[model samples]
Target: MKYITKNKKNNKQPRTAGEKKIKTMDPALLQVRPAMQESAGFEATLAFSDMPVHQLLKQNIQNKGYRYPTEIQERAIPALLKGADIIGIAATGTGKTGAFLIPFIEQLLHNKNRTGLVVVPTRELAQQVAEEFKALTTGMKFRAACFIGGTNVNADIARAGAKNHLIIATPGRLLDLVNRKALHLNAIEVLILDEFDRMLDMGFINDVTTIASLTRARRQTLLFSATINASQQTLIRQLVQDPLTINVSSGKSASSTVEQNVLEVAPNENKMEVLFNLLSGDSFEKVMLFAETKRTVDNINKQLARRGVRSDVIHGNKSQHYRTKAIQQFKTGHTRVLIATDVASRGLDVQNVTHVINYQLPQTMEAYIHRIGRTGRAGKKGIAYTFIN
Candidate 1:
């Protein structure tokens, strides 16, 4: 029941689990070139001012200090604003949030009567999108109600039933409200599925399908994902109509801003020791550690706390309140390390995350990209290290 932790003062080595079964390494997975580099972008021909966005939205953009659009934003905004159903293929932190938000706000400004629904995969992402919406639509009389899990269902029902211009939600809670006749989607004009693939991965595709069907006649349908698989193509086709496909993702890699490498933990080597050494270094100011299961994430967080390290954890097992609080602590620098499973991998944006450590290998390269994508955001450089036993 003990974890291996290193004490540099004494060069102490602690006991760890027995040797794990060695799996064949995929060269393709190992060749994940960093794509977060500043130069690794599609050159934009138009600035924020040049786009046909509403003047107020434009001013709001300027107030936010957004001078130019990222490649995805630059290409996707115009189409989204033109009322085209869009499939925006872009990684997290590539300004994909703004890409759709700006144009959608503009459209709303032009016609306030139109209602919209933005469905995300996780509760954290639902909150992040809501905050971004609030920030971007400052001074505007836009009303949004967030219906995520981990809150009182009755309270959410009241809010969902109230008049709102937009409904930002997670699939489960939204469906619950819809089933209760608290939220009506028959008149929804815009439907946006952010982190589309993640939702599918979480087995929310059926729920998403139900939600999208309710808005079949919506004016616009926008789908955004870091990675898309062909198996989901049939479902995606059912979501959008005559959609303009836009892809700014750099194939498999996330960003050049992240320097990625792997570490080999010998049979007797404590992976915790390697992680501790990294965190003790000056470069890893704030770190996000990823494990494969809820138990592992909790174990690591508990061990770190035992060692007097400030860390917090979030996973599917945690309530929405705990997850939100954990993220808040990380944002306020109250926690040096935020440990979790792959739940935090998609659409969770925390600024200035200096490094990301994969305590164990992710099941797929896509998950690795998203995990590292948490760092190296907002044009900041980051480091990612994976432990291979």
Candidate 2:
């Protein structure tokens, strides 16, 4: 007997099938305003001395070659050390990671069992945060477990089962572990939502709400973002208690140190040709190129290879091993050019990135800021080139 299956019409359709859809900013939200200018010839000379940080942490800070703190760090560290829930509004490359890490490390040193949880939007950011924690906690007896996607579940389960003083993770994986009872949030004394805007932009609000609800009610919650929208404000009002608000960015666009320009190309002109022309210049050393899709990134990498351009590509399609290796190669100058999607826009901190080329414009102005932020970091001069067609 032959059996026939009836097709059911579903009202809810998946937004995407195989590849991830590129998120676009609403045009109604796009109004070009004058860039907020910083005071000329005015320098912030704030050192970390006045803060209530522990002596051991101070020693670690000096050892890490950090003498003066960035504006956000200088302001946030004091309150964080005082166990204050804070809402930090700062742009990328503003030492926001250090602002939160130092206080958390100091807190863990006093009480090892008081777990600290940091939820980020991307795996790269998680890895970077973990590295920062390790660097600051050097020679200290503290363990950190990083939970992200595209990794071994059994290994993560084992790591989570171990008594970790610090936990850095992406929302989905952390929520999965929590559901499986492999990780407990009840003992979490500190909860940090880094890049909260990015999390909201990536549609992880539900997961974030669930995870935040699972944590201790009296936890010291810190939410950091480039911009705070209405949704993020609502979340903050619900999650934090009498939060100390700090906005060091002052509504700035990309870094003023970066020379921004646009190249106009005709619709019939091949973007690869334009990119090749740009890469042909000697000044394009240590460049990062941003594309919109994994297929586009791969294609650009392959084309650059054919033309003998030392380039590497990273996106969701590649395994974690390959992605990490590519980033390392790019960081070590083994690869002159790195091609990526928006995945690399946030939480990618590579030094000496001389140029950031937007092969295609990002869907939102905020994303554009992050993509350009990969360069002009650490008070270094860099250039941002955007292609217009």
Candidate 3:
């Protein structure tokens, strides 16, 4: 759980973690060379009116209605295209996906059948990124696959081997496939670690380290996080080469668009009743309620059903089919209330969610922010209420 960014120029100190096992490889296979020429300007300012990347890819970008680059995209994309190791620090919902996805897709388009590996913290995030990458590469006949938990392992391995150009996955499932000797990392030249901080927080350090070691040492490595503490910096240093750093202007606090409020109540005094009172209005439809445990989620769903409110519960213990159904009901308006635990916070990407209710406050402030982020997306106002006992 310790994240250390390898200082940009510092040498790695040898440490004993079991016996240090080293593998010898051909030196030629280990050298990762930049395929694209380096540029000095941001992609945002580049007058794409004439710059040639690929007429077809440029057309795809324009069709996506993206006329300008975000701060992270503006700074990071050029470096990424030049194949530099990069560490990007920016708040959530800042189009970090596009910053990497554009370059990733372009590489695939130009290089024909090359694979890029993207590692995330959770299954939802893996699916979300895969969807976004798929969208960007639309009309281009490149193949991509997602390898994450809650799915058949044999199915994923078969998909992974079928000439896919991109693999977006969570660390656990990716490492699982690696352990089974069902995945091939030999062809992957681009490796992106999105939400690098969350992976560190979720006890995925050892797994991520092992997965990263499988790639060519000189692969283009992109590390992104909301906040990069000292330890994460050290880890990045150890894992990547000299990485260009981009620090965007974060609001020095939680998301500015989200309206945060608190409600104090007794522990035994039906939190569901309090939730009903808060959600009594007609203006909110897409609502996400969070509790601290799977038992609490089930209890809340029961109370909501008793009150004639159609709701669904999602947690770790539920089958993947049930979890998917719960998410679908809330998303499609078949059921307006989605009850869940902290597990749904990081990676679910349903747009226009109007309210996020914390039936129970998270143990830490970071968890609180990520929970509320499920709503108020795509530049719309969202409300978050916390029930304190």
Candidate 4:
């Protein structure tokens, strides 16, 4: 084995090892270069500004203090407005929901009595989309409902019946609603699948296909995912027609905005110390922490409690009421920290989250992106910190 040697006082390694002894370099000879260009982080850009529909929609955005469109929003919104099927590949927090929602709302506003369907991978996301739709469509008469697990199915159906022109639902519950004859998809003109890749990863492909078949054949479809690689081609082909694919790199591994760092610690004891240090600082107002298992979620919550820090936990093992309560608490600022497995962290809709801490590294880089996305949502500046070893 041979090692490359560099001259003293200068850090550059010569192109050839023989060059080291050939020249006496000046003091100013050292020139350093990075392997890649330093990232300025992802910034939001407006893609649909001057269009008449967006100009009408811009008033709602400006009133909310959202001056710029995120990358996903910039790219996905125009295709949606053009009546083109969209396949959006963007990071978790790049305002994807709005990218699809704003145009859907505008279309619905133009054609009354026609409904839209948004299928999400999780209950949290279903609720989040419903809330965002409600917020953005304020003062408008359009009604929206959320059909997800844990809530009263009867109530969701009633809400759907009363005035819902748009419904955000999870696959299982939505299928259940369809089976019970409580909902009809034939009237739905717009169909959206948010976080479609996660739904496939969760084994919802069959359910999604079945649900899609229920809609009318001429319906407009929109699909959003963190990555739209070849693996998703079949699903993509089945749902969308001649789709306009927009790949905005917003996944966990690629986000330039988040300064990702991993902390090395012992198996269990050092975890709290790392968390406390990150949280005790006044700079971060909201933090989302991820664990690999539900048991870890409980244990970490207990640890935080003992440390006199108020935290909430949500996972598959928790009851629906508990999960909903935890989310509500976190959203209202009653709890600054929410601890859970990937279930709670992914597809969670909380804006202005300043930081995301991975108590454990996920199995893949994509999961890391989705977990961190909860913080840097809607083009807001945020950070993600991870713990390793």
Better model by lDDT, 1 or 4?
1
**Candidate 2 lDDT, 56-97, residue by residue in tens:** 788888887888888788889879988999999877777899
Cα RMSD (angstroms) for every candidate in the order listed: 4.2, 10.0, 13.9, 11.1
TM-score of each: 0.91, 0.89, 0.82, 0.83
lDDT of 3 by residue, 42-97 (tens): 34566433444577767777877767776687788888888888889766666788
User: What digit string (tens of lDDT, one per residue) describes model 1 on residues 1-389?
Assistant: 01223333433334234214423236356744543345744567878988887777788888888888888898888888778999988877889889888888998888988889999998888998899899888999899999998899999987887789889999999999989999889999999999888899889978998998888558889999888877899998988877899877743656776777767665565667667767888877789999877777888888888888899999988998889999999999999999998889987999899889888778777787899889888667788887765
lDDT of 3 at 229: 58
lDDT of each: 0.82, 0.82, 0.73, 0.73
Which one wins on lDDT? 1
Model 1 stretches astray by more than 4 angstroms: 1-28, 31-42
- All candidates in order of lDDT, best leading: 1, 2, 4, 3
Highest TM-score: give the candidate number.
Answer: 1
For candidate 4, lDDT tens digit of each residue in 310-353?
A: 89899988888888889888888999888988787567878677
In terms of lDDT, the poorest run of 10 residues in model 4 is: 27-36
What residue runs in model 3 are displaced by over 4 Å at the alpha carbon?
Answer: 1-53, 62-65, 249-252, 266-269
